[model samples]
Target chain A: MHISYNQKEVLKGINLSVEKGEVVSFIGPSGTGKTTLLKCINYLEKPQQGEIQIGDLHLNYQSLSKQDILKLRRKTAMVFQMFNIFKHKTVIQNVMDAQIAVQKKSKNEAYAMSLKQLENVGLKDKINEYPSRLSGGQLQRVGIARGLALEPELILFDEPTSALDPELVEEVLKVIEDVAKSGMTTLLVTHEMDFAKRISDKVVFMENGHIVEVGTPEQIFEKSVNVRTRQFLKKIYAEQDQQKLNIKGG
Target chain B: MTLETGMQELLMEFLKTLPINIIIIILSAALGLLFAVLLTFVRLKRIPVISQLADLYVSFARSVPGLILLFIAYFGIPKVLPLIGLGTYDISPMHAAIISMGFYHSGYISEVFRPAYLAVEKSQHEAADSLGYTPMQKFFRIILPQMVPVALPGYGNALVYLIHDTSLIFAIGIVDIMGTAELSIARSYGTNQILIYFIIALMFSAMCFTTDGLVRKLEKRVAIR
Candidate 1:
């Protein structure tokens, strides 16, 4: 798989194969093309070149029609960083829409499945409420629940906690941690370095549209061979450490 | 004027042509829907030079007075189709009124819908895409359902105008409730313009008010969240 913007490449000639229950975390600073890679997998941005395969289905950028692409998408759900639930719809309707409208599931079955997904995300109580009525963290949890109800084999998370308040980030992260444990192949694009260190089975570091470094948390954090990865880890952890020191010192 | 006699006479006269009025409004609205759908497809396709011309068509229809459209359709169309069916010279103004009202309001309704279709949030499209809905399903389900609530006010306004414009049916010679009232007043007093105008205005105002009232109720009921 590959993603290119202009002449610069992001995830150039990426040949990683993810098994079921494997979790891949992409860690990079802004403009590293991590989000673009995630969008390409979901068929949101049709890559100008490259092939992406999910299980038996071969997804070429050109060969897939709208029907084929939508069918592929139903199997792979992306949890947005912004928690992009339909604000006009209630939490229940947002979850149930894919089931009834796309899956052609019965209303009763869809409702039950939605409720179960909401319960799993610890959001069963807020099913009738609007997205605006929920906290940012709660909204993100509902977003996960909405994705879960789609029954995707591969779930994608686009920095679920990036937009949350510092205190609320933990709640959304915890829900994601639960989803990861459910044995679905999940690709997460995240800025939370510590969270990625703790949760992801494998982490890939990218810069300037290239996979600069990739390894286990220990390899990435403690034993990264690439100079860019080392510099990025230092810069990110240095800024975060300074913030914590300021709070503690004050 | 005794209450019972005057009211009964008025009711009898009004009831006599209410069916024709009902037919006119329903037919015009149906025609309006047909026009809106055709125009929407034309706009969506962006068909070469014809697509650019949709704007001109919408603008021209909207700018021309509905009364003049009625006059033109009743007078002009007959000339165009002189041999319409077995030398029948007396084509009903009812048909001309339907065509005119449908043409005039289609301009406004299409504009209502064009923006309504666009105003759907970006995330909604992404949501449909992620869920595996084809373009057709996305347009019909995700997009159009949301569009109804957005277009409600404009649609309601158009329907109300349809009622009011039924008054212009008199110019084309349709026997609408308004036309019947005007004819009654004219025959009674050899052109009592004041009474004729008052009766026609009051009758249509009442119909338009009730129709608008219903539209408001529907708007509230179907409002998104």
Candidate 2:
């Protein structure tokens, strides 16, 4: 895949794939194309070049029709970094909107599906509340529940925890962990190294618009051969250690 | 005419013309809103020639004086229509006021609508798309509803301006509130001009204050939090 903005390349000829029921995490510094790659999978960023295959469907960016895009999107769901729950809707309505509008489900069916998904995310008590009324963690969970309501074949998480207050991050990560354990295929872009290492089946490291290394968590975290990967991990580990020391001292 | 008789006449005239003033205000505002939606959609879509045409229309409408536009519609259109083989068009003052004001107000309202729609974050569009919403569904369900609260203040202002501009219809000989007041003053040999004008001013102030209060109530109700 190749993506550019205003003639400046953002994703440079990258290739990666996820297996069925596997969780893959993309980790990189800001502006390194981690989020862009996830968006490209759903054609949200519309890479100027390359083809993407999600299961049986193939999408070539140049020739894909609007119908093809919609068909591909129907099979996938994305949880945004900002928890883009519709502000005008209550938690349950946000979850139910796509079911009724896209799946053409009856109101009763959509309501049941929404209730089940919201319950799965432990938001059974928040069904009537608007996004403005929910905390950041709860809002992200609502976003996750909305994603799950679609019953998509794949889900994408674009820095889902980056926008949350530090104290609120755990609840959202716990919900994600549960979703991963349920064996749904997921692609996540995350800054939480510990969570990524704990949950990801495969870890991919990217730098400067290119994928520098791909391996198992054990290989990437403990035994990486690539010099760039080692340097990146060393920096992140040092920051994490400093954070732990600060928390203990304070 | 005595001050007592002049005051009575002015009150009666106000009561008689109240419905016409309301009809003009409501009709122009409703039609203006419809035109604004069309203009905003065209500009947002960025269709080649049509979008440029919409831009030109808005610019011209905003810059030209409303009275001039009314005169163009009232007098100039009839002269131009026959040349186009559409036959001569003879529009009443009421029709002229409604059409010109509708077109004129759309320019300002479109300015309000565009930014309010844009103010909704891009994330909203992305979420809707990833959820597989069709373009139409996304607009109606997601975009339009969020725009309502943001657009209300501007919409309320436009309605108030429309009410004030209804007085311009008197120039075309429409028997609206302002026109009735003017006719009463003329009949009373200008002796009642000061009293009649003061009553007219007070009537407008009352309408504006009522609208302002209603808009505040609505704003509180639809506030996002």
List candidate 2 segments past 4 Å from native.
Answer: A1-8, B1-10
Put down candidate 1 lDDT per residue, B1-225, tens digits, no spaces. Answer: 786796578668877888887788888888987897788668767899887788788888788888998888888777767556545365578788888888887887888888888888877788678767778877876788778888888888888887777777877767777777777776767455665567667767777888889888988876776
lDDT of 2 by residue, A1-250 (tens): 1222221399888877778899999998889989888887787888777787877887778788989889878998999999999999999999999999999999999999999999999999989998888999999999999999999999999999999999999999999999988999988999999999999999999999898998999999899999999998899999999999999999
Clashing pairs in 1: A10-A209
Residue A38 lDDT in model 1? 85
Listed for every candidate in order, the interface RMSD values in angstroms are 1.9, 0.8
A-chain TM-score, model 2: 0.95
Please list the residue runs of candidate 1 whose C-alpha ends up more than 4 Å from where it truly belongs after superposition. Answer: A1-15, A245-250, B1-11, B45-50, B79-91, B181-185, B188-192
Model 2 lDDT, full chain set: 0.89
